[model samples]
Target: MNHKEINSFYTYLQSQQTSQRFLYQCYKKIDGIDAEAKSYENCTVFMYYLDHGIKFYNAGKKLDILMQPILFFYGMVHLLKACLLTKRPNYPESTSVLAHGVSARKRKKKDYTFLEDEVKVQHNGLFPYVSQHLFFIHKMPFEKIMMKNLLGLIPDLSHLFHFNNQESMINVSKIGSHTIDFTSRVLDNYHLTERAFLERIKPYLPPIVEVKSNHTMFQIVLTKPILEPSGPFFVDDNQNIFFPTIRENFLVVSEVMVHYLLLYNLSMLSRYEAEWWGDLLITKPDVDYPFIAEFLRISAKKMPLLIGKELLKMK
Candidate 1:
């Protein structure tokens, strides 16, 4: 497609209100064409469609479908954002806060022993109701980067794994907000089933107990279960297997699939709720509220289906 056609396509997508099926058809048609035929100017346009398709699949109500697409979309967005933001400067600044207190000389250091107590009190406060969005956007990236690195180390799969390939598959895992993303590019490039890929690299996977304390906790608590039934399997550089446990590993995989389904349902519900919330917010931005709260709520709701489709291709 030419630049004009690309622009027209984007404009049409932006303007048309339709069911997800219609949008999917459009994506299938565009994706079927050769990228080489498109002009440089149309590249961004094509990317936008790809991005949109991902968003749709991710927000869908089906976890099974949402898994791969979300990963792929995330990878694409990560690559795009990295390209655009890498050289951009970020400024650092701090805010000042007012202090509260009592008199000077009479207030001995012992009197301030309560300061430690007060600090403890503050720490105890607000430990629960943490923001999920912040956790997903900020904390999850580091974990994902690590997972990507682990997948990268999978010997034979390493050649097929391109961390920087924008179009690569083996997109995100949907086990949880923190699950590893896989993209279709990985599957397509490797030409292997997920099970086959895992089995091939089983010999190289690090021992479960060998991982560091901090990393081990998260992996054990959050990630290991999902990958269970597959193995307590560990790989040496020489491709030797350590743990031969089988039944437990399979159970873990089953649990992982359940978690993925939960996340998928949550994403769908959140998106549906966000649409109504967005309408309400649009009519009243006068209220003192964070736009990001609304933005994330809406975005989360809409992403599952789009991301799901991209992931389904991996299978």
Candidate 2:
């Protein structure tokens, strides 16, 4: 969906009655809570969370690149908090849950590059909370991830990476509503036979109904339509799914979580490492500028659509 459509969709959440009804169902389904009572108390706060998120997103659009990360990161946080409320009901159960839930290196080396920078996942805070509650992902505490890997995970930016002579992903051809196809080269990349490949991916994807293959291509038939991203697979701008070229644990990281990590680090750099951030943008000192700029633009537009899709699934 486009920004206008997503903005209008979120606008519907402004209704207290509607939000209460929605939360009532979510609370009952997700946590078996007293749906009506909890919804009654939380609906207004939920609406405000979403409202604040959209406002930050809208304001970010008018700002310069230097300020966009701060706005977008907090905007993403609010939306994520709203999502958490649907599942957890009593979000911010403790002071720890309110933290950013991830951290960057305390100090950068003299020759540090943005792409080489990393963030370590924390045990408590919004990151892990949202991951487990909303997305059902359980991340290892203090697990470190590099900026290059996170950027490669975004399907929209895959082409940019390719232009820079790095192959990060392989496009999956959606053959039908319930089936997807990819070349045998994928198997070659992993050095796995069709049967072996299926076993490796079965843990990550939805249930498979059947598989069809020839020498050149393999077709995976799913039991149902893929409504959201899973494992190594991610939805592109056209809403089609693609696979990462490299098979790694970070492949399990959802696109939403990836954006959160990158934005958190960027927001921190923008706020605390202002001199470096300014030099990176104004001086164009390295190759990070184009990728970073492209990501900021893409994340500004795509994050809302992903969040909107998540909210729609609740309905």
Candidate 3:
């Protein structure tokens, strides 16, 4: 999308606060669905349906609400099947990339064949049936990096109810050591200045953020007072050496790397947990279930309402 289109969409989102309310009601109605249906699978379908309906509607046609959700449902089925077949790795690289191999003139024929065979074996071993399905998902129109950025914003949606309660406050101090290690890894991979990354995302950020970074770690604190009444609140810390921005608070803290933008909310963090969660999402082998669940809950509640209002205002 062009800058104007992006700006228009964002403007629509900002203007339609009631859309968020509608989304929350939808989530409340759909809450009892299986986690797979509620979270990743359903979300994939929702996005697909939105994309399809928007495309169709733009082609000089009336809107079809039923078509929108049905398209989403079909898309969700494909993603659900893939998720079930292949145990998705925390990172995409863990899966195979080669679907087919062609002979290369520069390499000896025998050597090329050998390499291809090896790759095929490795692909089969790592991905199996599920991996192939996942490959398709990766190929979907929305780039993985874009999805990551979008997902990073999810925490803000949930901040309404979770930000400052003692029970909900996330501790970051506990994860400091891990965060440091992860930050180092990110530096090794990207090698871009952190300031550039921050500049790219600056328009989306609130003022007065607290950032911490060393050769080995990066952390950001969004002081509670800075949050707007209608949010996009929470702190974020990225401990992964490859992705230094927290995927929860939409903040970037590293100064010298630029492979991917990490954004997340840190409202649930204690100082230590913030540090550790940052590190884990960036480097570790597991998905942060609580983090993912909370984000899904809030985004589902808020985003649709926001989008709906934007749609009404478009005319």
Candidate 4:
């Protein structure tokens, strides 16, 4: 298997690398960009990237040309997301102003007791949203780096607790999207028992959650509700995806297993999500998105077992 450079291949790579760095710098330059956008009365940098992304897709049939749309998308979405999560305000304000917005509806002050818990040296991290994605990449053999990069977009687990073999798991984390994507394809294509298959996988699930909220110092816990739902369908409320055609609407079904993976690892994963969203040090005084809190409210019990019912039906 041999391939040639798509002309400005190195240049394109440099652009992507540059995009990665500047996108990260959006936090620093956001106020200036915002001032310009506001003076010109235009959308913010985040929306600008998203709009360009859509335009590139709708332009025409994209030539392989270094996987332009996919790579462009990879860089844009992650960077834009980082900026949006950092939501710089129009005027001056303390950074924590946004932090308080996204925190969950705490039943009591005790709910945040984990904040006072002791810190420990930790290493390994969790690979999330793997179940649905793993199946698509491996079993279905979708060999695009789009899937690989999307899966790697948000790697690692809660800073509160980590595993030991992060060195090896990090490799798996990069390959996780492919692996999880492959797994879903296998489940549907091979007509495996969804219940029995997941049940069999229960024993292999890792335990890494350290709930320091209660009197317990550092007891390990696993967020495992997604593994076993009360009915054939698992209900999720926040999922609002639009695909006009039946053939093009596979994302809804495909993401069902992703929801499962998220549910199973909600504990540590929630913390990770919050920390990233709340990362204000990178930005000068900005508000953070409460992505973790919104994620917590997703009704898994109500979400349809998308892959089990829809994808399996297609098979």
Candidate 5:
């Protein structure tokens, strides 16, 4: 769905009655606990988060690019908190879950580039907490990801990488409801044989029906549509699936997590690294400008869709 539809979807949750019902069902399904009282208590707070998040995104749209990251990052965080409340009735059980849970370098080298910079995941706080509770990702303490790698994880931004003579993904063509097709040379790209490549992707996909191949293309039939693909497989804004051409390691990150990490760094830079942030925006310096600018634009529209989809599943 587009941003407009997703915005409306979030608006539905703004009602106390609707929000409480959703939380009730979600808590029952996810935790199998006493949900009635908890849902009633959390519904107001949930609506507040959705309200603040939508406002932050709205404010970001009217602000200058320099301030957009800060707004969007917190916007995503507040929305995520709402998501967390669905599963964990008593959120912020302690202060540890309140932190951002990720850190970028405090000092920049004279020649530092944003793409080359990194963020390290901390053991506690909202980042890891949501990673575990919302997305079921765990054991991510102290893991370091380069900014460029995180940017490459976004399917909507794949074209930006392609414009710079890089291939972030290989698009998969859908032949029918059950099958998908892609170039045979994808095997060469990953240095995997057809059998080996199939084995590698098996864990990420649904049950396979069969595989067929020709000199130029390979087709794999699946048991169901890839409605919620993951890792190496991603469904883009247009509903097309792609296998990331980036390293397998980078492909494992979900788009939501990728956006969060990138926005966290960008927000930090906007807040603290004032000199470099201003210079980059005003000077139109390097390729970093294009990637960062494109991401901000895309995330402004894309984040709501991502978060909205997650909320829909909870219902």
Candidate 6:
């Protein structure tokens, strides 16, 4: 607003190590997609080039433990959506959002509906009958023979491990919702819901962590240590601000600001990470198994925990 204010803000920015350093890096990459970048042949290689911090500066410290469990379960949720009905990225005659009667079960041939549950089950698992009656029979040789004779009988459960179809990846909603502890879910028999999980890690979180959701939301007061997954350095604020959160980290910070007489600004989000909260799809038409014989090995109970453990190990 005024010359004094402008100078003060600049000086305050210079004071923050993480914010100032990351903001500059983001500006260079603001040019958008790195088209000159090479096409990746594998997810590992692709993920390598897509390294979260590599585009900017490699973050000097380890990222928090909470990030992957949140994202993997989120991505896995997309897989569940795929099972709800037979969906295609584009259709035979025209392309739009429609699920076909590809479901081999005698259940509704064509079902159209959308759901937003913090669930961790396969598409078939969504059905009461499939999860209840078939719970034990699904494991028998009879079910295997049925799959051969019936065709498409087991949509989601039969192919739980297949990761080849890009269209099958989860579709992400652009905007988001706010919740204090949204990750927690209590299945009838299971006990390891996300809310319970966060509680396990609560002792490790510093007072800087205000809320935990899609991103770690931070409450910036005049002088609290604000830890962002973004980049290096954090700035001290002169004023009190509130409700600063991260989509990437599922963390929420509130009561944040800079300056009593001074001024400051903190950028929202670091390098965009779609995998954190988005769905999974198999972009390429043909890569590996078009069929899902391997899916039988996965049970509803074996999921989220199975995959969640692996994702955490990668971090």
Q: Specify the poorest-scoring 10-residue window by lDDT in model 3.
A: 254-263
Candidate 1, superposed: residue stretches over 4 Å from native: 1-250, 254-259, 271-315
Q: Per-residue error at 218 for model 1, in Å?
A: 18
Residue pairs that clash (backbone atoms under 3 angstroms), model 5:
none
Per-residue lDDT of candidate 4, residues 126-236 (tens digit): 111122122332232221122111111122211111232111011111111112112233334335554454454335334323322223212223454223221111122
- lDDT computed for candidate 3: 0.31
> Candidate 2 or 4, higher TM-score?
2
Per-model lDDT = 0.28, 0.84, 0.31, 0.27, 0.84, 0.23
Tens-digit lDDT track for model 1 on 191-234? 76555645554443323332122311212113242231122232
TM-score of each: 0.17, 0.91, 0.23, 0.20, 0.93, 0.16
List the lowest-lDDT window of 10 residues for candidate 1: 120-129
Ranking by lDDT: 2, 5, 3, 1, 4, 6
Q: Kindly give the number of clashing pairs for every candidate.
A: 48, 0, 45, 26, 0, 46
Q: Name the best candidate (by TM-score).
A: 5
CA deviation > 4 Å runs, candidate 6:
1-179, 186-190, 193-196, 208-226, 229-283, 287-315
Per-residue lDDT of candidate 3, residues 1-315 (tens digit): 123553354344332242243233344443343433333433333344444434432331233221222232222222223233222222134334322111112222422221121111122322233323322222212212233343433324223224332121222222222221124443334454666544543453345355677776666454332221122223232211122234333332211000111111222121224444444445643334344434433332332333333333322
How many angstroms is residue 103 displaced in model 4 relative to the true structure, after the best TM-score fit?
32
Q: How accurate is candidate 2 locally (lDDT)?
A: 0.84
Which portions of model 2 show Cα errors greater than 4 Å? 1-6, 30-32, 204-216, 221-225
